[model samples]
Target chain A: MKNRLKVLRAERDWTQAELAAALKVSRQTINAIEKGKFDPSLPLAFKAARLFELSIEDIFQDEVTP
Target chain B: MKERTTEAGDFTACNVKNNVRLLSWVFAWVVTLVLADKAELYEWHSSAFISIAAIVINAAIGLGVIVVFMRHLKGLDELQRKIQLDALALSMGVGLVGSFTYSLLVTAKFVIDAEVTDIILLMTLTYVVGVIVGQVRYR
Candidate 1:
């Protein structure tokens, strides 16, 4: 999955640690998600969407073509 | 104040508490295990009676370690929990394999003085390596 997490966090001027704190996850987790090494779970994706005030599709895009 | 994160990656506040409790339980289990071994070896008190008592206490503490570990897993964030679960699965597989090989060695008239502790140590080492690998892989 591809996500705009890094771009969004940068737009908000939030460090990875700050963003992690907001999401109640480790900075490593946020880093992993941004790097596409790990995909966020549904609840975590929802949390991120809520934090960013956007829909999940707005933040995350499926890399697979339908 | 700089936030403290003692976990392999970075610890959350609840994770710190979970880590402490898990460590405390593990330490207790180790201490009780040593005490039980010593009691059995030295024939302390009423020999069999003291040995049984120590073994019982040690077993109960071992159970505590298991409970604490389960809670620790539950408290971890998703990625951390996944890493831990993967490491545990690997460790368990290796432990079972080691046990079966040891049994074979014993039945084959091999005079090796290998103990169950050896297998346990191997499993622990494997789990540590597995966690480290997972962390690095995700990094």
Candidate 2:
């Protein structure tokens, strides 16, 4: 999956650590997600969506899907 | 946005508390094990009762370590938990494989004077390596 997490965080002037603090996760997790090396679980994806005030699809796009 | 209620990163207060508990339990377990082994080796207690007591105490501390470790894992973030679980699985695999292979070698008269502690040390080293690899990969 590809995500706009980096772009979104940049737009909000939020560092990875700040975003991770908000999500109750480690900064490494956020970095891995942003780098497309790791995929978030459902609850974490939902949490990110809620934080961004957007749907999951709006944030993460499946590379092979419509 | 939900208000940030605590400090950033993975070291939350609950996590720190559980870590401390786990560390203490592990320390106690190691101390009890060493004391029991030394007492047995030196014949410090001729009574079976003292040996039994040592075993019981050691087991209780080991149980405490397991419980505290489980709680700590539960409180960790998903990625951390996954890494831990993976490392645990790898360690378990190493333990089983190493023990059986050693047993086979001993039975075949290819090796001699082996102990369970050696296998345990191997498993521990494998677990540490697994955790380090997982952390580095995710980082």
The digit string of per-residue lDDT tens for model 1 on A1-66 reads 999999999998878887887787888899999999999999999999998999999999999997
lDDT for each residue of candidate 2 in B32-137, tens digit (9 for 90 to 100) = 9999999999999799999999999999999988888888899898988888999999999989988999999999998888888899899999999999999999
lDDT winner:
2
Go through the candidates in order and give each one's C-alpha lDDT: 0.87, 0.90
Model 1: per-residue Cα lDDT at residue B83: 92
Residue B6, candidate 1: how far off, in angstroms? 17
- Highest DockQ against the true fold, candidate: 2
Model 1's alpha-carbon lDDT is 0.87
Instruction: Pull out the clashing pairs in model 2.
Output: none
lDDT of 1 by residue, B1-139 (tens): 1232233335576788899999999999999998888776776666677777888999999998998999899887899888999999999999999889888988896847878888889999999999999999887
Q: How accurate is candidate 2 locally (lDDT)?
A: 0.90
- Our model 1 lands, by Cα RMSD against the true structure, at 3.5
Model 2 C-alpha lDDT per residue in residues A1-66, reported as the tens digit of each score: 999999999999888878988998887889999999899999999999999999999999999965
Model 1 alpha-carbon drift over 4 Å, by segment: B1-11
